[model samples]
Target: MCNEGCLIADLELTFTVKGSHEGSQKILLDSDPSLRIIVFHCVINEQTRLDVTLPEELADGNETVKSGVLSFPLNSLPVQKEIIVEEEAGVVNKYNNRKIIANLSGDLDVRLGFNLCMEEQEFLRKRKKYVAAALKKILHLEEDLKEHEVPVVAITTTGGGTRSLTAMYGSLLGLQKLNLLDCISYIGGLSGTTWTMANLYEDANWSQKYLEDAIKEARKQVTKSKICCFSLDCLKYYYEDLKERTKEGHNTSFIDLWGLVIESMLHDKKDEHRLSDQRQTVDNGQNPLPIYVAINLKSGYSAQAFREWLEFTPYEVGLLKYGASIRAEHFGSEFFMGRLVKRLSETRICYMQGMWSSIFSIDVMYVWNLAADSEDFWCRWTRDRVTDIAEEPFLSMNPYEVDTCLFTPSSVLSSALRDVLTGRPTIAQYPNFIRGFQMHSKYLESEGFSTWKDTVIDSFPNKLMETADDELSLVDTGFFINTSYPPLLRSKREVDVILHLNYSGGSQTLPLDQIAKYISGQGIPFPKIEISEEDRENLKECYVFEDADSPQAPTVLFFPLVNDTFKKYKAPGVERTPEEMAEGKVDVSTILSPFTTREVCFSEENFDKLVKLTDYNVLNNEKLIIRALRLAVARRKQRKY
Candidate 1:
């Protein structure tokens, strides 16, 4: 596919292309991701980027580059062309007539590293008042909680389709009621929980305001019929949305269609808000930073075999393993060689929400067998178009090195359109910003990429080349680990406490065990999450894990979705009356839960029960949560960064 970006037309190299006996003795006839038009840089300098715009008449079907400027449609690709130069050197360059487009240039928007982005850094400063007030009010601090002694506290939840989407509302409501939401530094999610985050973030001041109304709204959404999403009219709506996106040079796959359904389910009317728009909520740090999680899987590989962690915040969208990130607004825009070449319209947040929680995209059993550790989902997207993919799709390939295969992928939208025809699940690809860029030569041997002995492609030199490919195939993190633990564990985040709400709903396997194994392999400092098999048979409302071996391991307060003391009491000390007893008898069994992983509909009664149960679970454990927070504060005080 033709990259919809800019290129550098060199007049000095044009002479070499015309069989010149003498010139610079170097010919650089290649594709650059940032240029458009055939406007040649007649000056011999190959490194300069000129700020020249083509005249308006250039797009009037001009035959070729003329009057020192080449005009072509923005969507056209470059092809072999004979150009005559008016320069004294008699420069002439030959490239195919395929039209190439130029991208707007300025300072790059990407911020590369493991450190937090500047916006997030500025937010921490703004959040000091709210957190101190929360500590005093929630913990009843005898003295002020100093800003310097503050601990980075985070809350995380797992995915279980609609089950998670609704239960998360209850979980956050619980936090808000207890005044715990104000103390959190970050709130992260996987799959289903993202839908809840997207909904709440729209309110901007969601955390500062009372949460009952939001939970009530959630009740309405869950109780309503999801049948309309599959109605004939909805299909037409999806078709039109995708078609319009394609015309605007954006990619549209089956996932895009799924996003529209999610959009309708969450909002009755059109909500045109993008993720960047939510920056208003955290711009002054009134709320916890939101981190949405996904995993990057290679095109031809099984998720179990190769998967990398990806995170989306209102400030940025990036892959942590590569330590590479782009501005949140640049997510879908085309990028080549570390520069934003084509700025496609930022996708609506609904589309991103769909990608984060698209459990229906693949077979349920496949998701269960390959995964099923804790998270719940349906059809898993595994691409079968292996042969059709470019052999070294991660890196730029020369024409002669690879056969003249009928290359189909041009822009991401082109591949997305292909997915529509085949009816197979998509890889949720975006333009790889680091495409055409190489990793550190010693990346394999460095402590950065891998500290463990996994045989993953990124670990081996020959196989790691795939990291340089042109598109990123990001899928739900559930396809690998069932939780969103990796991003929070990044060392620079300096998190002291993690309130992990296990909304993933399945009962068989321990999700934390899966997370522990993955985190250990990545060499992150995390509390030892060891739960006995006996404990597995019977879950509790909450369990706290802390590091006895190392202080760096953040304390974890894990609350599984189990109806325990909430069924026995109205509050911590208040016993339930006979009529109220039934209110507490909410069933969250993996098999019998009204909020099952695949459950899309819930009665108002059951919905309230789920929300209340989750709320009670948090309320009952108030002392434990506070103790964890105090411990986190002490840990923060003793540790020196």
Candidate 2:
């Protein structure tokens, strides 16, 4: 794809070599490979433009008190001075044996920049119509609501394999029944719940249609025989899929393999669905715009110290923190210094799903344990309470940090494949768009990057910009926080309400102590979470948390996946008979529970039980939900006045 004045070199970091001596610090080039040296450098014209050795503050560290900040409505990017070191040897083939003439084509650069893409801006303008109509209908307002006056309502669902997938459908079903589905302006999720959003968006008019049929189809997929997924034929299909993706110059990892497995389990055939294709679902403001989330973390960076959240929409894939984005179709394409170097085929939605929900990157057993622990992690927090020693191991061994592994390959193929991918990092790779950008000198005091004093390395400017590497390691947002709140929290979004569904293995959905701390730390406006000790231990099905003192903070309605009244009343006021009462007794807390995150093949009965529970819970809480919506509108009007 390169014409002239183009340089392509493979960058391999060798940690073991330090002047032919063994060490843990990473030093590029040579053999030792024992020491991990952290350095950042930029090169132009086969010469080093800038190189800085990163500090050791984040090398061995835990979570810190870095205040993450983001500026909204960035209409202009920081003007950067490009430095080009020149050499006349570029046109001459000194490295190649054959003399070749270079093609100097017109400099028609295509780089998605810091300003919000035009596509999203147009989407917001169109989406307002739907929001206005839905708000007027649901709020029972006689007068038609003005488009600008409409409150931005978002629904955020967390991830948990099939459990979340089934529950998401049920929640949406209930919303549709209540005529509240259209009221939502945006819907987003991470991990398994993304599956629900993907499948729904495949149908352009899903939000307008009755969701019962979709639910039934999802139920079938969830209940099918997963054994065949690992069978030889499916394995061959996976091999070919990976082979093709690799041939296309895509980085293949265990995550890709898991995506193929997920494809077979959730889909009947290979699909051409891409994130960009979903624009049709929201083209006429007929459906909520979907925001799928993934996070970026460097290989050696402290998982706790740094997290770069990437939000994907039909229009663009962006990092709200940096105010930088690329067109959705250009997401996986190679880029350098704010220019698209090479264009790869847009990634299929299945692979996107894999990147969004990459829990299988490591071993399954450990993931299950993490799920079992994560359920209550939110509730077990106090402002004074630190993540106890018991939780350290889980925190330290992030899935991306662990070696990628495979399961259930028949005969020797599985073994051979496992060996080939055994040591690769557990993350999907994409060319970093932020590459070649220089960090602001006084960024330590900048409003965008708050000067943090709490963390060791996070306090350093160079370390904060260290993620400006060649490739971005995008993995499931579950690595940072399971909730899909980050993207919605962007100041530009101006969201007024958040309906958070905890479909993962969690007893408490609102886990305010944890979620509150995280949001407050980032300087985002969120409701105060003050659950009493009594409430923390025993979570309620629905919670409405808000900062009465601060109207800017969005009102959050948290719904945890707990078996509550759905047991006594199967379908919102429909009482279960003596014989059918057993159906209400859903095992939501056990590792072997029907709603376990680890189980892909849920029995039909369990699927119904789980799906119905979410459906029934939403229906039962309809009055409360509507009340919240009304309050949100009232607040929006108050602000308008």
Candidate 3:
């Protein structure tokens, strides 16, 4: 959407390319692609535009520093510049028919300026190598490693690096160099988790594409007079089309009906006029649209406190820029149970399908559980609470992001379909193919599962909680959280499995002999159970203390038996270092520090089994249990009858 005589702003953008190439360090282009490059030259409130280039520096054959900084002049004047690099065409193929269009828009003309250097020639020669290695690492880690499978890869802080737009440029360049661009797909998930539509990052065209797709669908539905259809015939066709279009459609899909509503409103000219009029009514600035946050009460953040924490966060302002409003929901003390019941009850009212319904409901429950389960979390550390409780409606808080858990329109659609088709109540549920955790560990140990599978093992120490009158003592014997007493006991009986749960910090108090005896009790175990002198030394390093400096290692607590009486270790009166706050250079709020245990507590076998047997009973509804049992019986009969 461009206008005539618009002042195109000439801005120097710098970012690093995170990929590699085989030879020479020149900026590479794709073989066959539509180049939609829009370089603008504009004057924002009398700001002067200057053209400049920075020299890049190389270190040990690697490009380490980018040169040239753009300094805008203080004077305000009508500036005229020449179109310098328009005719610089690349090696073209007749079959490709790629055209680079030079269009003058608004008050600015745009052109490219390239500065090549020979210093990084050697590095450039092996650029593709580095890129390929990095990508290979990423892929290998994703597919093989069960512990560190990356669910999301966020590209940020681009312009400041030696290779500007390094990650994005590198990914695209890598694809071209390897001739894999056509083979792989770039999937975009659009989120409307915010209160309003206008407040969003426009850097990625994916969001726009999601919107465009929605518009196309809404237009088709409107044209066919199928918008009013309640038979779900349109929905059925839409899902089938989605499955064919997406690779992950077999197990995942998402839909944003709220987005459709917005499209329909825009389709109506009257609503469009009202929207324009509302925009003009902003005297100071645009008011923030409302946002809804649902959390479990166990996160230790009261509804009021969480609001304050949000106010203190950087995204608080950023979210406002995108027409967002915030509200918090504390789902009482029973996180999983409350969520399971709520979603099951409210599914019909929200007009949601499988993924959308599951994600929206489950995230509220899961995130809340995570928060409640974290330590020393102060929810009200920042500002005054603007709104209280679960005040905002779910429809208003349409799109949102909690940490890395993104719920977008596309993802919602996929998830909904997967949920319905798979007969799964929650996306987090695992199958009971594993007997307790034994079968699960075997599955993980297989070469086919990937590296993350190794994360399923539980080697950490468990902490046992005691009553107030009980003396505080650490025993080598694993114990339970006082609150988890009934559930743990119930689970032990139902599954015939002993539970090991606690915080590792308290493991130090347990004597070595006691630990050895406990391990000896684990029948058919290896000699590693016999703690030697060297083992004691190693165990000391692994034990809990405030001075623990295992880089990126999350403090873990476990319980073998469920109990309610657990000791809460308060963070000593010391400020956390900057390094402590950033989870691999990502700044998460201190309030969420405890739940940041990145490591899975149980072995994969244990977790999967626990999820299958315990999570369903603990995390789902009784009806789900009945349905699951019936399904199992039916499958058995199918094999027998």
Candidate 4:
């Protein structure tokens, strides 16, 4: 069958003729096994006539063989000519005017095929126009990006709740162009739920670079005079963790110092229903001890440099007890918070799967498992709260209150800091907090910087290809587990096997029903079967039973059947037969019966059965389908580069 969204054409044909004398004549032709015959009607020129002579006695004691004369329509053409027949060469001719040759030789034969001659011409005309339009838009966008001074104009995406590995691979390629691998550093922690969440902050390096670029761009506008982004929102995660821990009156070992400072500012307005304990305290006069070493921004921290500092932090002591020394270095501050036995007892227990819930991020609020059922929990987790430090200015101002308050350079820093500090550094008004933000945003927009939504949605496909590798091998399977189901298929952590049947080959309907029957025979558990009506109709065209044929594609199989015309018919018998007319016989002509039958299975065993019985002509078809399936599975399992 022709592929969907495609065009097909037939360019040549061969016919065979047989005869003994003036009164005997017959015709035959070669056929292709790959294609199943769908139609046999043809227009014959009026010039040729065929007359048959009957032998005195027939083999079955009947003299009916070739006893009559047959001729094509007369007076339908401008001229008429005598019939010419070639017996040895299997060629047939009409007055030697038209060409004829022996038919194709094969056991699984196809006498006719559908041609898409007109459709092909139309497709070429339209495809050219589509390519031209898409090219113009892409070129225009590329030029706009180049004009802007955007050093790292990357498209970012998230997988599960973590940043997508595809984006990272693309970024690496871009950086490689400039040979900046050494100069640039990637930082971030990955959560197990990277495949389940699409949250950026939970990515191992979400705040590592992209966030750095964004925060720096914002800061440059805030400073007007030009300030390189020296540090990222390293404390952002800590602050989020703190808010959750401080609810209890006592400091939970899990409360990182930075989180505590941010949480303390919310002392006046207590909400018990909130995720964190709603305990209010006075000045708390007790100085919050640093759980981990606070690094000076001046000393840049690289993966190598961090190892040296980890040697000194008191946080390392706790990791030694748990025999997770390497991991302690990974968490650093979080490990510091985990050290206090008192804090662990007071902190609320929460279970989070996927990357987002475990990671700290000021940018992304939170992420939940696709299987997560608690709406209340999900809603509370994602509510965007700027940091708690900005809520109460007076309390945040005291150096002892919190070492630093992370305020947007626009509001809190310019207005509140200016009034609080007796004498601040003399700086240019160019970086007037709020105004700078507007200038930066306007500059980016004027340069045609697209929103994150557009970049990821539009360029995601291209970026994803960057992570693809041909070396990977994938598993091919059917009957995907539906994660939408609750309690059973939804939260299932294991993979289940399935059967896939083909519907593109001959006698398709019969094969499908046969497989379905086999499935029911075995008490194998499966999801409710959903059969498509369009597929049922297409099955009539498949004819594989005669040659034990099947579409090579695992999804399409065919079976063939024999008929008196030497033509083939295949398809499952229908439950209802058509009504007979006064002649007492149903007209087969109007039924448009199947040329073949095809069947589908949702079980692996059924798939094997189809494979074993597949028509030999298209031996490689199933392999092709298997390859495509494997590729898809490989894509799903690939990790970020």
List where candidate 2 sits over 4 angstroms from the true fold.
Answer: 1-115, 364-416, 442-459, 464-468, 510-512
Clash number for candidate 1: 31
Model 2 residue 16 CA deviation in Å: 29
lDDT of 1 by residue, 1-641 (tens): 12222233432122111111111122233545342233321111233222223223322243544323333332232233322322322223332132334333345456666678889889987786788788877767788877777888898888887778777888787788888888998999878888888988998899989988888788888888766554446646766788888898876676776678778777787679898998999998899989999887776678888777779999898877767799899899876556665788888988897688755555433323333233221112212222333456765456557553443333344344335735757557777766644566676565545533243576465454444465778788777777888788887777889998887766624678888877777777877877787777887778899986788788999999887788889877899998888898888884766766766678889888888878888888988999998887777667665
Instruction: Give lDDT tens digits, candidate 4, residues 498-579.
Output: 1121222233244335433432332222233334686555323222211112111112222121111111111112122233
Best by lDDT: 1
lDDT of 2 by residue, 410-482 (tens): 3455554554355545788887876655456664455434411223464555765554366888888777667
TM-score of each: 0.77, 0.75, 0.17, 0.15
Residues 534-603, candidate 3, lDDT per residue (tens digit)?
6444332112111123211111111111111111111123333565432122111133322122211223
Error of 3 at 219 (Å): 25
Number of the top TM-score candidate: 1
Q: Could you tell me the TM-score of candidate 3?
A: 0.17
State the lDDT at 631 in candidate 2: 83
Per-residue error for 387 in candidate 4, Å, reads 25
Write the candidate numbers in order of decreasing lDDT: 1, 2, 3, 4
Report how far residue 439 has shifted in candidate 3, in Å.
40
- Report the number of clashing residue pairs per model: 31, 12, 101, 58
| Residue 72, candidate 2: alpha-carbon lDDT | 15
Error of 1 at 456 (Å): 1.1
